[model samples]
Target: MSTSRMPLALRALRTLLWILAVFGAVGLALGLVGLAVMTEEEVVRETGVGRSASMAALLPGFALVLVEAYLAATLIRGGRARRWCVRVLAVLTLLSGLLGLLFLDVAGLFEVAVAVLLLALHESRSAREWYRSGTETGKPDGAVPAPTG
Candidate 1:
């Protein structure tokens, strides 16, 4: 928790989390819509067969979206728990992306794009150094140890 790094790191984490949350919201919305189509007789009657099937297939994407949002929020808090959430979200994102592509869902492509951008932000040079050195390991480069006094 270096004083200087705290502000910047928190800001970066917040931005990344918010971005993931937005994507998750979209997925959740889509999932709810799909569920409606799957269960409602009126929806089927109105939209017909193909659209209903398409909606049904989108359920998993929506579910994954909620999970991603939770993980992103956890990431901001920064703990062992948060780290685990990140891993889960990463895997779910990959799985959903694959499913979306296979089913020709455009939302899957959108998820892929956002996930890539967030990953780039998280893996930026500064972020990595902060993660590796700031937490529990080496001191910042060029930092001199204090005199024994």
Candidate 2:
């Protein structure tokens, strides 16, 4: 995109994304371990389902980890795809936070805060301009220069 230096806010967002990704990774690992160690009866008791159904419960956590990792990499590389990914992540985070609140999980409130911050940054004029700067037009700033004689 614009070969120019990345904005400070974007840099900060990237760092935050990396941190979130790491957290997701750890959560995923722990979830997998818990699943592995759970006895069939324990799984049924906890989920009110069979072993297969209990294992399916971890899929969402795995997906979250994958999405976080992809977002971090895209942000790091300054990929054109990052804009869309950030938007998706922000919405997903907000939804997750809402769900958490509904379930009375305190941690969901924190995710909601993070989602708000991300949405604010992404919607800012600077971030919009940055995302717009790099596009299929192949011109920096997407401006058509005046033709010279």
Candidate 3:
């Protein structure tokens, strides 16, 4: 199918993923800069947090950004693997949100929102049709109806 005819759900999901990837990248860059410019002693003095704790916190976020970037690419290209990736990523995101909640962090709300949006888009009728069509062709909505005899 032409890009113009693509499902709205797929388009929304792709857009959301890209937005998340960009934000995560920006956050990671800022984090790296903060780390570079500040000493462990300074961090402890300023925020009562250790440098090791900050580094540990960023690692999972960095991993999440990598996953979001990969998922965005897979969603565009469309394959059976993309379906699996969506499911797995959604589950992981949900788990992350739950962990955040356990820690009483407001950031958990964002993670939960991302997971809900991801699942909702994947499960929409239009997106499912789009994925089914793509799976048949192993290409991004490339399945075409047979010509009339």
Structural similarity to truth (TM-score) of each candidate: 0.54, 0.78, 0.78
With a 3 Å backbone cut-off (N, CA, C), the pairs that clash in candidate 1 are none
lDDT of 3 by residue, 1-149 (tens): 33424578877988888889999999999998898799889988876889888778799889889988988866766667877888888889899898999999999998998999999998899887777665333245555556779
What overall lDDT goes with each candidate model? 0.58, 0.75, 0.81
Residues 13-103 of candidate 1 have per-residue lDDT tens digits of: 5566666668657766776666655656655665665555757666665665566566545443344555556555655666667789899
lDDT for model 3 comes to 0.81
List CA RMSD, all candidates.
7.6, 5.9, 4.6
Clashes of each: 0, 0, 0
Q: Candidate 1 clash total? A: 0
Candidate 1 vs candidate 3: the TM-score winner is 3
Distance from true position, residue 111, model 2, in Å? 1.5
For candidate 1, the TM-score is 0.54
